[model samples]
Target: MNEFRHVTVLLRETVSALRPRPGGHYLDGTAGGGGHTGLLLEKIQHTGRIEALDRDPDAIAALKKRFAGEPAVTVTQGNFFQAARLFPHPGFHGILLDLGVSSHQLDTPERGFSFHTSAPLDMRMEQDGPTARDLVNTLDEPSLRRILRDYAQEKYAPQIARAMVAQRSAAPIETTTQLADLIAAAVPAAYRREGHPARKTFMALRYACNGELDGLEEALLSLFNLLQPEGRLAVITFNSLEDAAMKRAARQLTAGCTCPPEFPVCVCGKSPRAHSLKPVFPSPEEIERNPRARSAKLRVLERR
Candidate 1:
């Protein structure tokens, strides 16, 4: 296996904003390699505690080794969106979610998230979940088009989805290389090589396979009662879709009413749940070292 060299993006800024207290409880929702969790635990050495969660088994195993015999830590294997159910704690002082695919997953050919390398069309963050191949091969043209258009915002979604449906009839699209070639053929030759044509299709498929955006809203709602008063919930999102969801959730949680703007008097009984701290971005220095951090956006909420 290749060495896991994930340089946790937005490391300094994320940990610094956390401002962890010695006796407080914290959680790292996506503990890839334990990079951020390691720092959080170090801050909590004598009095605080850390609960680390990861969907990837390998990451769980690696983190277990990295934090072994540390009474200050607890490691769990599963989606962080399901955290409230998994953790025994009624509330926590701090929570950090780094929502991005790890460098190890992308660089490993067998996992198939990158166009630079040819591999199986498997993009499961969890090893056992349904993969890109299954979605591409089984969904109807209209369904595929909706996924591409809605999730990836691909302008040529209809044409690409049509072509995919027609091609897969001959045989199942089994490999990432084959799928990439098919998407290239679907796009106009004049537009070819401007960027990988398969990029959007792959992203849409992965999002659908993982049901990423589907459960996000509810997860945020669940976390509202799970954070202690004055506790912080920090989320780091990689794309606009995820960022938008987080933004809307925070707004809803913090705002006093969902009533129409024309309303002169308060009717809706919804009170403010949390306050939105301004969203933070990666520093140019951090982006220079890791270009993948370029699009990352971090939004934090403080329970009221």
Candidate 2:
């Protein structure tokens, strides 16, 4: 197996924001490489317990090994969105979700998350389910176009989708390099010079293949509901789509009366369930050390 070395983005900021305490019950929903989990474990010492979950089998294995013989940590192989089913009770002191692709997923060529390397077009975090290859090879042009535009905000989505359809007509686009080359050929030369032409396209494909955005709002609501009073939910999103979704969810959670200005009292009787803190960003030093951290944004919300 490839060495799993994921530099946890906003490590200190996330832990400090959660304010873990002794005997506190916390959850690391995305236990990639166990970076944040390790920090949480340290802060809580041996008094608190953490339930760490990861969809990736490799990450689950790593976590199990890393926390072996440690009574304070419990590792599970599952998705964060399905966490409610795992733990029916609603009394978590804190929950941390470091969203988006992990460094290990991108760095490992076989995962097919990065356009920098040539590998089979398989971007499944769980290593099961439909893959990037299936989407690129089987999806119709319109569906592909929608995923590119909606997920990645790829401006030239139509052209890229057209190029994918045209290229795949003769042969299957089976590798990351193959799809990247096709995207480079489809876009204008000036656009190609801006960045890796395949970056956005690959991102879109990965999101679609993994159903990254499906039921996301519901999941966020579920997570918030599971939190005890004053319990915190800290999320680290790597893209604008996730950031915007989080903002909208936070607003909904913190929203008060919906009654009109003329109304003397709120007939709707909707009270704020949670409060949001200012979103946090990575430091310049962090960005310099890990360029991938440049786009990361951390948002924390506390249940009322």
Candidate 3:
């Protein structure tokens, strides 16, 4: 746990959105390194409790060790999407969902999340199930292209997919560096110079391998529904795909009057369930301190 160093992103901004109180129960959905969990605990005092939930085994271990013997903190290991089953007694005052990989995961080379290292292509956060290596070595070219295009919006998905299939046919694409270099060479020289061509491809593969975006809306709604009246749900997203999902969930909850304009009168009687707070972004100073925080955005919604 001591080595699990992660610079908490938008720490104050995200937790402050929750507007914690001393006796109100809350949840830290991502709980990586327990950064958000710690801040949430600080503001909440000792009256109520918080559940720190995470999907990664490493994070779960770290969180458990960090908050050991603390009555106010209950560390749980599992995806927050199933939070309903995890915490059956709802009426949560606030809930947070920090979406994306943590710095610890990327910094640890053997985890194979970053292309900077030459480790085996294993991006499984749980350190279980299928890995990036499995997908890259097994999936057909069209499937690979679709993953790249849909997940990361990679413009050169076709070329990259073709290159991966061509390279893997001769030998298994078993390493992060192998895939990264192949992607670098497959794209145009100009695109290569712009940035690492493998960045998007890697992101897409990780997202697919982990099923990150799958059923995201349903999960958000489930968590939101757990909130008590006037309770808030704050979410921090790193990628456009995740941000878009957050936006859709917020809109769906806050939407009202389902009847069409052509009807000229309400019929279905639909009304807003929740309302959003102003979205927050990292400060320039925060971004300079940690470049990864630059892409982070915080959105909060309070139940009606």
Candidate 4:
């Protein structure tokens, strides 16, 4: 198995934001490589407990190996969106969800997460779903265009989708480089010069394959509900789509009564449940050390 080498983004910042203390029970909703969870374990010591979950089988194996024989740690294989059901006992002291692709997934060519590789177009986080090859080869142009536009916010989504369908009709687009080269050719040369032509397309496929943004806001709210009063739900997002959903969830939690100014008496019993702190970004030094961490943003919402 390839080494699960994932640099935990915003490590100190996220743990500090969560404020894990001895005897506090916390949750690492996405325990990829167990970086953040390992550090949090140190802070909490033997007194505290941590419930770690991940959809990736490799991640689950790594976490189990890393935390084995440690009674305080429990590693489970599942999606963070279903945290409430999976972790029936709520009232967690803190919950963290780091929504970024693991470095191992991208670096390992077989994962097909990066367009730079020449592997099969298979970017399944859980490793059991329709791959990028299946989507590009089978989906219609309009659906393909929608995935690109909605998931990655690709500006040339229509052109890319049209080209993808046209090329696949002749023969199935099979590999990472095949699709990457096709995208490079489809977009204008000027756009290609700006950056990788396939980056957005690849990201869109990963998102679609994993259902990353679907029911995302509701999931965020559910995770927040799992936290006890004053417990923090710290999430780290890599792109605008996820950040927007996180912001919306935080806004929903922080929103108070909806009664109008004209109403003299209190009507809506709804009050603020949580408040978000200032978003955290990677430091210049950290970014220089690991360029992949550049786009990460950490947002912490405290339950009231």
Please, what's the RMSD in Å of model 4? 0.9
Tell me each candidate's TM-score: 0.94, 0.98, 0.97, 0.98
Q: Which of the two candidates, 1 or 3, achieves a greater TM-score against the reference?
A: 3
Q: Which consecutive 10 residues in model 1 have the weakest lDDT in total?
A: 39-48
Tens-digit per-residue lDDT, 169-282, candidate 3: 899998999999999999999998888889999999999998999889889999999999999999999988898999999889999998878997899899999999899999
**RMSD to native for every prediction?**
1.9, 0.9, 1.2, 0.9
- Sequence-dependent TM-score of model 1: 0.94
Query: What is the clash count for each candidate, in the order shown?
Result: 0, 0, 0, 0
How far out, in Å, is residue 249 in model 1? Answer: 0.5
- In order, candidate lDDTs are 0.84, 0.92, 0.92, 0.92
Quote the positional error of residue 243 for candidate 1 in Å.
0.5
lDDT of 4 by residue, 1-304 (tens): 7777988889999998999899999999999999999999999986779998999998998888898998888999999989889988889999999996888888999998999979999999999979988999999899999999999989999999999989988999999999999999999999998899899999999999999999999999999999899999999999899999999998999999889989998799889999879999999999999998989999999999
As for candidate 4, its clashing pairs are: none
Candidate 2, residue 24: how far the Cα is off, in Å: 0.6
The global Cα lDDT (0 to 1) of model 3 is 0.92
